[model samples]
Target: MPFSVYALGLAVFAQGTSEFMLSGLLSGIAADLHVSVPAAALLTSAFAVGMVIGAPLMALLGRNWPRRRALLFFLCVFAAVHVVGALTSSYGVLLVTRVVGALANAGFWAVALVTAVALAGPEARARATSVVVGGVTVACVAGVPAGAWLGGQWGWRAAFWAVALVSLPAIAVIAATIPAGRSGAALPSARAELRTLAGPRLLLTLLTSALVQGATFCAFSYFEPIARHITGLGSAWVPALLALFGTGSFIGVTVCGRIIDRRPVAVTAAGLVALTAGWVLFASAAGSAVAVVALVLVQGMLAFGTGTALISHVFRLADGAPTLAGSFATAAFNVGGALGPWLGGLAIGAGSGFRSPLWVSAALMVVALGTAGAAWTRRSAPALRSDVHAYEQGSSDG
Candidate 1:
């Protein structure tokens, strides 16, 4: 169980690095490809858009396959996409490759969640799930910064190459460590997963995910410029600052499982509140380097801390369709990813300083907090399919 969790986490880390690496190397990519920063930003947006479209679609396609085979297939395609991305010289070709890679990434995550939960056998589901998915947090802390540095020193293409190399090994690890089995329950039909997305509870969860994640990425997309304007940091220092924030995210991911298991609603509400405060502080105290870095660390933790909780929240809400619920949540995340930075960029274009985006982001988190509080006020939130007694009774057996 531990090995499978770690293997999936590593695969997710590699994918996460691939997704965010472009942000760190945006300037280099723009210059090398003879395009504007905004044009290069489109590449980032394209990846998110692909995930938004691919999450449910790919999940449906693999609805009947054994989870291990589904994962292997996706990782193989993911690796190939990176290889193509690294080798492509034409910006147009690279853009297509990135979109393809993002689709594979979405599929990998959707399938991996089910596989992780099944492998844990419901007893340690929360912790096992967290460990497997913590790869994204690790990427935020370590992989993204490493990719950024490699891009800065070697070239943007080199970062993609690094991701591909890591993914190859991750594929091998997952194949070796995870036993052969169909990870998700066999659906009567592919459309069955859609039921999870249609309910009020699931809808609310999706809305919260979109708003919270959108706010986060809105500010995150412009981190480098924000750091430069506020902290007077050079480009050379940006990656290190990113790494510091990532460290905080790592801590958040490690602790989130316990927090969620104890009280899902309270933890989520608290996380959003913290996220709001972090953004507000970032916008206000951004002029001071010390203050900015402090807020950056806080922002990383508060923003990312809700990730696993949110996933668990979805599963609880759907009670009937865990795999579908998980995939839908991922789709919501992609929706936020696609929209957040674009909104921030719009604000930036409107002559609002980089800090302006933080205001918009903070406001969004405030709204999310309100929604989460309302939905999760009771100890027996509707999202939780089973009560404490039921969960406890079943734990020993599972």
Candidate 2:
């Protein structure tokens, strides 16, 4: 709620922009570097893999530092990597830059998130966290499209340069606004929280989260190529399409926020089923530009809707440990982020064509749907039965 909280969100915006901007730039980067599109796509995976590995590791390594200091440190490193990435001609060096940038972004996220919550105080934790998350959504809606457009005009390296430029201002904001102190309250050590993840219900929640992300990104990571090769769109349309996808995501999260708490399991199940259906239809429809365009919005909506509900469920399951919840959610989603692009890349590399990624997306959703069903039958059935029994007894007394 405070200016400091918003400043933290600004930092998050810079990191998220870099995280997602690569999808739009993949084609250009590939052609320029003389690599296949699939190979270039691995940059997304590289960044995600780094995030998966970096969040907790960076958090631990900087556990003693002031939150503001850590935030500046990470942002500076993030900016530096982008500069290196932009300057490099070699695909391999660029790939390494993506990984390094992600590590820095992951560390900044780990530190900044708790700092925002700490700044907002205990009762407003979720709201504060949402401010940070809202930054990512805005990055999707605004930053990604702008990055794509910039990449289209000046070159892909321009997008990387743009991220570095934005991060500098963000760094300044964080330095000016965030209070210098211990990043967050000392709570249960991450070691103690490991036991919480062992629970079947929590694992199912995380699995659903991972699968849904993987499914969406399988197609999404290649949206540019899909537009170019499959839909027959020019480079100009790619940025607009990416914008539409991002708009759908913003709307999906907003829609889910209204209803997830009341029917979390049901919403997740329905979203997974719809997303699966959407992907299958998309595979069949890829030749039709109109169909492909329309389905992008539908697919985006369903994917984020399911994903939003799953994250809420994750927090609910890990309520007692904020640090654990944050790190676990980051790791789970990025696992999907990393895996989705890599798997999709493999499909493309195998000469499966662009449609293959759509099939891959659908397959992942099928697995997610199964996981949702297992959670419902295995975890919710007992609770449902008890509620039914109480209702029956009350009726009999009446």
- Candidate 2 vs. true structure, TM-score: 0.79
Summarize candidate 2's per-residue lDDT along 1-398 as a digit string, tens digits: 68887777777787889988887788899999999999998898788889999987887766667878888898898999999999999999999999888888888777776676667765555456556666776798899878988999999999989888987777787788777776445766666666776678888878988988898778887888888998898988876787788778766766776666666667767787788899999988888889978988877777776776777676767755555565667678788887887799899999999778888988988898888778767687788999999999999999
What are the TM-scores, per candidate, against the unseen true structure? 0.88, 0.79
Off by over 4 Å in 2: 1-5, 22-45, 63-69, 84-96, 112-131, 148-157, 176-179, 183-186, 225-236, 258-263, 348-352, 381-398
Q: Residue 25 deviation, candidate 1, in Å?
A: 3.4
Count: clashes, candidate 2? 0
Candidate number with greatest TM-score: 1
lDDT (Cα) of model 1: 0.79
Per-residue lDDT of 238-351 in model 1, one digit per residue for the tens?
767778778777777678875677777778777877788888888887778888778777777777777667877776666667556657878887788777888898998999
